[model samples]
Target: MTVLSVDDIRSRVDADFDRILDVLSKKIALASISAHGITGEHMKRSAEFVAAELAKVGIDAQVVQSHNPDGTPGAWEVIGSHIVDPNAPTVLLYAHHDVQPVPDKAAWDTDPFVATTIGDRLYGRGSADDGGGIAIHCGALHALGDALSVNIKVFIEGEEEMGSASFIPFIESHRDDFDSDVIIVADSGNWSAQIPSLTTSLRGNTGVDVTVRSLTHPVHSGQYGGPILDSNTLAAMLISSLYDENGDLAVPGIAADEPVGGLQQDVDEAGVRADAGVVDGYELAGTGSLAARLWTKPSLTVIGFDAHPVDGSFNVISPETRFRLSLRTAPSQRPEEAQAALADFLRARAPFGAEVEVEPTDNGMGWAMDPNAEATRDALEAMREAFGVEPINQGQGGSIPFIPELQRIFPSAQVLVTGPEDPKANAHSPNESISLYGLKHNIITEALLLAKLGK
Candidate 1:
């Protein structure tokens, strides 16, 4: 089997870049929102679109539906296999076609479904999140062509943006189809537009629903204002207990002092603030480097709260308030332990014995890639060669729950995480996008790695 030279790979990718973006644009127009209230017809169309695109590039692809938690049908998942040789290393390319819903259309500068290019970015709903991921696999395959010697399997999910509810069940059902030597998950972000990086670790996550009960029924605030407080205020106090003076997580049993898997580089404070869109006149939180606070230490956020809306007249004090707490555990910590500790803490600090109850919600384990693995070395070399700069090692504060499941099912397969989303991608937001430069380089890097694995 022949391998594509680096120069040849770059030339091929450059020539077909437009075609790649064209496919991405079509996908972005699909609006395959996998959340509740969305029709499954669009998901089917998205999966078929992905399959057709992969098939156009010479891969034998098909769409399959996985079973949801209740044994009901779930979203469509695309699986394409191109077997170059039985003996060569088989690589599984993972991405998703589902996108987040556009909540505020007025906030977007351009149509959320239209692929609008401005400056260095191509903006749309799923442009960077996973649409670019699918584009990467397709572009690499197209560029490599006959020179791609390794067996290739493109696995594009349809429910990634919706918490991947059927991930475990789907994988278990199709375990044999997903077996591979190397798995590349192109669903994370690069360090920046000019610097490429691989995500080495991701924080684990769990949620606790804390309910504070003050009265059996609603009471007029005018009548109860002097003597008793509302459950909403009590819930606020319980939430405040999770943070300290410096705004760091004050949980006792969770949040280890240090990041378990250290990175070769750390993020700049200014860069973090800028990327996160932090407001002015605000100080950074926690007592460690920005990387530690983001990637390793436990963080708490009030994700969902049930209360009376201010739009309506709400003079009555609601009897009970329930709010969902999303707790991000360190990369090395178990979510089960974190959930237990958080529940205990909330139950203990009930704000003057307001009859508090904490119930655990959805949870996922953290992940740390083997930095010294052979695949890791190959990826670094590929990034260096493609980007003409040393790659940065970074950790993600968010959790990809299914990644651990993939590793668990394919324990012998080495996983490599790469993507086209830069800090400015703003994925899941109004003006989400992908850097055109990063997309090209990531395609090249994957092509180079594939060539290397084929050897």
Candidate 2:
């Protein structure tokens, strides 16, 4: 058995860091951002690029196609596998190639499409969120080269950012192609720099639009002052009822429990607030643990309210108003059930004699990792060897819908979430960046993991 030392992994990671950065920078420049995600052309191109790289590394690669019921190409996947031993446990590495839309260029320090390096940090739209993740995996594989002793597979999806509508079906259709003993999803981040972390849970999400219609047109406020119902007033009342005075969600049938982990540090809190531009006097919910509130408890947010604003104020009662509600449920909760419960709650809580309609827009389940698995143990050991630190187990607040679906399909596989980004990475926000030191260490950790698993 060849045990990889930290120095050995570090040397290999340092040697390939520049090349890995170059690859990621070029890939981000390709503008694979889908349009409402109906087209797969960009996805296909991204997968092809990944496949080409694998070919250069002497690994046989292929594009696996999954089509919709209408026979349209729904997803394009790149599969690169090196089967060193037929009976060895196969590991599947996953990352998404698609990026979110870059809406405001003025808010960004650098062009969102151009991957720029400034003072040891790379800035771009998807750099830390996922581009860096893909690069890490590729770099690790390149470092492993001929020393690999186990079968390895790389699977990249383009629909993850868009709800992964095609992912579950594709996995079911091509079940045999993705057989693996472990799944490494390199899309999440650590608690902070120098602190390696493993994400064990993710919050599920359900969205709904609530519309209130009380009259045909805006009526004069003076005339309607007597008893006429106002949609705006009703909308406000309904929205206000979503939460209790304690800042906890008040929706019926949804569960809220304390998170398993503790709250983030003051530094982490400051970083998150700065990145998000949160206003003063506003604070995150839950008393004891930040991670618990984020990952374990339920949260309801009004994404958008469609009532007329003060700019276009009129002396009349608005006829209709609509608001978008986004509910983040706990990892153990079912999103569909939550959505149904929300709908029922809204129907029952609507103001008397007011017409209320609740409609579900999207729903996705949360993911939980099985800790007692061989692959997880190997990964933890590998991370410890590379970072000289024990990885902290925690949970993420966001939703990665495809993760739960993948777990369902591969029940016996170990799911590991460790990536290069830290708390200050600013993923999905302006001035997004990745720490050079963190990226290098993550690359080393990944290489160590590959070497360990291969052995």
Candidate 3:
């Protein structure tokens, strides 16, 4: 089988780019928000759309179902396979189709479901997150056409944004279906728009819900404020205890891993401030370089809290307060151990004899892959050839729970992570967008890597 020249592949992709964006627009319109009980018609439609797209590329695809943790229906997982040759190496392409909810529609410049192009940026929810990933895969396959050389398996996950509630069970029931020689996860981001990057490590994660109870019912603040402790105030203190004056994680068990030596992205202070909407004169928290704080060390986040409405003026001390805590562990740390330590800390720090309970929510272990693996080296070369720049070696601070499972199941398979997310992509945030330049280059790199591995 002869490989298509890079120019030919690029021509194919450029010609079909509009169709690729059309498919992505249709998917974005589905509103497949897994966490918001969107496992019904919308989810089904999204999966079917992907299946049809894969079919266009001569891949046999279907929608596979799994149950949510609460026994409710879960999003449909789209699985597609193309066997070019029995002897050639098989590659599994992984990305999610589900998207995060649009919390505030007013924040978006255009309708969240409508893909709007402003110059080279395409803006919409899921436009950059995984929708871009879905588009890249479809575009690459379409561009390769008859020249694609490897046995291919495309897994467009349905519940990744919901922390993959159905991941383990879905994998358990279809273990044999996912077998492959190489796995390419297109769920991460590039180091910058021009420079491609490969994620070498991912942080582990765990979450806990803590509730503080000070009284059975609310008490009048004017009458009881002097002696009575407010549950909300106590909860604040408990949260504050998790971080010291310097903003480092004060948790006992969570630990950082030794940094991977390579070409790491230097933090752009202005970029960080703008992205975070940080106020003037605010100092960056924690110790060490920004990369170390983000990718190598544990970070704590207060996700949500149960509190009174600020609009409703209440002169009462609250009876109960609840907040969710998420801890991102180092790549080498165990999420369960860190969760246990957090529980212990919360339990011991109950203020003013208030009743405190910490319930663990979820735990996902971290993953690290060999950057020097033969498949990885081939991928790097392909990327360099396609983009005309050396790929950046980076580590992701986010957690992809099922990656470690894939490693364990396919012990010999190489895993390569790549995607089109740049700093300005704003995935999972308002005004999400994808760089057109990055998207094209990523598709080319993936196509080239597939050709390289196929031979």
Best by TM-score: 1
Worst 10 residues of 2 by lDDT: 258-267
Mind giving the per-residue lDDT tens digits that candidate 2 earns over 199-276? 778999998999988887788999876587688888888888878886778788997654444333422576567767
**Which residue runs of candidate 1 sit more than 4 Å off their true CA positions?**
36-39, 215-230, 257-261, 307-319
TM-score leaderboard ranking:
1, 2, 3
lDDT of 2: 0.78
**Clash count per candidate:** 0, 2, 0
Model 1 TM-score on a 0 to 1 scale:
0.92
Q: Give TM-scores for every candidate, taking all chains together and pairing residue i with residue i.
A: 0.92, 0.91, 0.88
State which candidate, 1 or 2, has the greater lDDT: 1
Cα lDDT of model 1 by residue, 45-151, tens digit? 99999999999887999999888879988889998899988998999999999999998899999999999999989999999988999999999999889888899
The window of 10 residues in a row where model 3 has the poorest summed lDDT is 258-267
By the TM-score metric, which is better: model 1 or model 2? 1
How high is the lDDT of residue 240 in model 1?
Answer: 91
lDDT of 3 by residue, 1-455 (tens): 55798887788888988898888888788777776765777778888888898899778999988876677777789998999888889999999988999989999989999888899889889998899999888888888888888999989998888777777777777876788999999999887888888888899999999999999999899999978888989999989988889999998888887456454566677887998899999999998778778787899999999999899767999999999998999988888999999999899998888999989998889888786789988988988988899888788888888898788778888998888799889999999999999998899888888888887
Every candidate's CA RMSD: 2.4, 2.6, 3.0
Worst 10 residues of 1 by lDDT: 255-264
Steric clash pairs (candidate 2): 259-292, 263-290
